[model samples]
Target: MSTNDDGIEYVYTRFITRNGKRIYHQKGGLYKFPKRSKKSKS
Candidate 1:
């Protein structure tokens, strides 16, 4: 994972998931992580 000026970038590696028929090693790719909006109470 890396933090850039625009957003956060994450790289996935090879690994089999425990459930949801997901596999990391087979579906590895470079993708950007979504940023959450912070809510402030007035």
Candidate 2:
């Protein structure tokens, strides 16, 4: 999973088949994790 700078975060899981083909799942959602504060570690 990776988050972009434009406030768009992508959540994906990678799966490999027996044929050695790479498959990626792109689930759709605009999720925002609460920003970490100076007093808290995220």
Per-residue lDDT over 1-42 for candidate 1, one digit per residue giving the tens place of the 0 to 100 score: 564545454645565345557555656666555434343334
Please give the distance, in angstroms, between residue 35's alpha carbon in candidate 1 and its true position after superposition.
3.0
Q: Quote the positional error of residue 15 for candidate 1 in Å.
A: 7.5
Model 2 C-alpha RMSD vs. true structure (Å) is 9.6
Off by over 4 Å in 1: 14-27, 36-42
Model 1 clash count equals: 2
Number of the predicted model whose lDDT against the real structure is largest: 1
lDDT of 2 by residue, 1-42 (tens): 566554554543344333677554365344443334333324
